[model samples]
Target: MAGNVQGESQFDVIVVGSGAGAMTSALVAADNGLSVLVVEKSDKYGGTSSISGGGIWIPNNHHFAAKGGKDSYDKALQYLKAATGGVVPETRLRAYLDNAPKMIRHLEAKSRVRYAVAEKYPDYYQHLAGSLPGGRTLDPELFDTSVLGDELPHLRQGAPSNLLMGRIAWTARQAHKAMSREFGWRFMVLGLMLRFKLDFKWRRKSKFDRRAALGTALIASLRRSLQDRKVPLWLKTEFRELVVDGGRVCGVRVVREGREVEIRARRGVIFGSGGFEQNQTLRERYLPQPTQAGWSATPPGNNMGAALEAGIAAGAATALLDKAWWAPTIRVPKEEKPRGVFAERAFPGAIVVNGRGKRFVNEAAPYLEFVEAMYKDQQASGAKSIPAWVVFDASFRFNYAMGPLMPAQIMPDSRLRKEWLGTVYWKAPTLAELAAQIGVDPLGLEETARKMNEYARTGVDSEFMRGGNVFDRYYGDTNVKPNPCLAPVQKGPFYAMRLDAGDIGTKGGLLTNEHAQVVREDGLPIPGLYAVGNCSAAVMGLGYPGAGATLGPAMTFGYVAANHIAAAA
Candidate 1:
């Protein structure tokens, strides 16, 4: 271990973590000609953002204008007000909406980060006021990983199960056809294979790198920008505490390379280190009961509330401690990380049921809404809904991907012999047999299947109205007629997988005002302290308005914080 280093490093700005929020802050600050240092606790950069779908929900962005879509501030505000039930202040929401477009314009104009509108993706609640079929979500464009050079190896990677064969990255548009085994995707797969072959050769000399998309692409683009700007990043450095002078935060004490190091931030210390989702004690104390840290989708060794704790010790106020960005996740036996299945439940010929084998939700609802339904069922029936089972038939499996099981892929016979098949996945010749194998009531499953078949034929789900909304059908199999989201479970063998209530990250953290400055319990800004992203209380409050709700405010406030620091300078 090295000896203590006191005041050996100094910068105008210090950013903790390497997620979108932290990266955005570092980039913007550096662009303003400020010396910035980024410290990441993990071995690699990119926190939960890297593993995410990488969609940023920006209302009235330039892409909307280019696509001839009209969106107004008042209209966007109206939608946010209704969605969040006015829990988030109008000033804060306005800050997010107003700064969001500016952030996009700045990043595109000055940095390597590029974005394109997801033309087919709809708002989570399309039926609500001020919602559009598309144009609100901006997905990061595909990035060439070779651009990162030596920095490529230091970036966190997306889950192997999320990618194609652990190398190829597919866009949302291509995924539908690819997972369904459509022949059109063959050419796309071939192109990816050739690219990976070349990438593998390059990897032998350096590290694994290829064309990356989704969250990985977003982070890579930002990292490329950082490298271009020559900003310094310190990995394996943990923030220990804040250094306060005259009751104002001015620097931070950190453990760097197994030694204590004191770094001074001449301007301010921006806390974008993410949330406490990976901290089991914090999760149990703040989140709803039964929601454990093991169920979080965030990478291991995340924020763990270090920033929040430091802020609290400095007299900061906290909010929304009980909320999170919820989703449904399943852990396969062989897979190291749990996978979040967003589209599987919404696809045709599938239903999510409690232990009693009864459908409790509109399986076609958004992931957050689906998890809310799971919690409601759990509250009503105890542990019955803790591990909800997603049941499907042969036609569904052949036409759609479930968890890590791609369409048309065969499970080995040895899996069944070792009972691994029934552990994470269950398959049987009949509904009764599947229920018996999974330990659910056979009669209830039989009746449920009978009603589902009737609904499929009639093109209506009378129980939960599964296919009633545009958002529901957005992920549905459009090739299927009448009701694209409905199909009978008549074909066997059927399949079932247990899903638990999981979250992308915790939403609760240090509270900040509209300017992205950390606020004290007395409603005053902490002079030299700032917070953004999951490290701060979510600007959306407890409600998720769309697909990129989490990243929207994260990037916007990161922009807000950096600009504020620049103005102070």
Candidate 2:
């Protein structure tokens, strides 16, 4: 039932999963004169890449060369070594550093994908030995979805948090500016809205914007390139197992249209089907305790680690099985997945607190570390921090967006749905009243607020050292002096939004080497078997160096895998 492209059971390379990494591998392999087939388990393509922020973190990128800004290999090496604590293989780290930029250049030159540097984004661990202030993250340019032709209807929609009104799209750079209410942001948004409204023809076709940005744009560009090459992307196909002959992965068994089909990959099979974060059994077995699959920001049930299990059956080793690309997210009414609270936590006039109504971690810390601190608090101090509250006041509500609630200017309390008041968000006029409504200690909440006020005045977070790093300050308001990340919660009408220890994806799966070849526990490479993306143990291990860390290594290694496959033959 699986109709092979060009009407054959064999392909030079077969890529599992249809995310950015899988598509990159397929496109690159096709460029190398190899026949390629891309398989997606779901009905739609793009995987989570379509809903993502689409920022690719590649240190020492071409932008630096163009601008005469130097990024030393030694320093990037230093930063990764410090950030990842040297648990990862040095060669694997070097492979990513060397090939990531090359992959970016190749995509721009050969494929529809185009990228521009995000100048303001900073490395999460700016204090680390080798991190840049910005320019390391490359944002994908907006792409016209019309290029995809009929494929446009099946593409995954961008997340609400990443879109303007959950319809129009904007690049990460533009989105951040508008969300922060930076200079001239209003005009930028107004122009985008006007463009969308003027496209009456596009409106008739779909409610979504024709101009794709963020993950959708990145995937759309790559998909367009793949279409040009006549690559076969099979939807509604479920990978059943890896087909092994003489201990080598020769092909894969999949169910297509309710019939089993065995497709041969002469070069190899690359698994990019993503991690098992959505599998509750795997989450309980591998990830930290008190974890819930619903809290995951990744597409539910999409990344159940079929490839990971298959790879393990093929004798592949794994590491970092307990780790994840952790983040804080808020679940909203009627939305299938939680909305990520990434940038909002760093804005001034807010703090994250456990049920004890005390600030346990720096509110502006990187999302991964923020959630890790929550678990640490829960375990070490027996604090109810798993479902910690982000408690702020009217000053914050007026100036900033919290989870699903936009700023008071755009989305006032009066506009909030009645069902969301006590569930999605909470509000009260006084500190005690707010604490009581949220079930936190009233005295503790009041005392924490008083301390925050003093800290705001002195421009110092004495306990947590917030606003002390370039990364945190980057997300802060420049108008708020002394420390951009510090502000008082003294205003009446306090507000609180619950946060979950969510993740973009899991960090562990099939272990791989520098060439991205699946390796056994004894470090022997498994011929004709490769892995990339979240299905492989993350290149950074437990460390999150900067924005787009997940997608960067995934794509870089996919390039590595493709080149290695091309060279092997």
TM values, all candidates: 0.95, 0.97
Off by over 4 Å in 1: 1-7, 176-209, 409-419
For model 2, give the 10-residue run with minimal summed lDDT.
1-10
Question: In model 1, what is the error at residue 317, expressed in angstroms?
Answer: 0.9
Q: Report the lDDT tens digits of candidate 2 across residue range 386-499.
A: 899999999899888888888898888889899999999888989899899988999998999999999999999999999998888887887787988889999989999999
Per-residue lDDT tens digits for candidate 1, residues 413-496, read: 342436448677888999888988877888888888899999999999999888888778877877677788899988988899
Error of 2 at 371 (Å): 0.8
Model 2 bad stretches (over 4 Å): 1-8
What does the lDDT come to for candidate 2? Answer: 0.90
CA RMSD of each candidate after superposition? 2.5, 2.2
- Candidate 1 accuracy as lDDT: 0.84
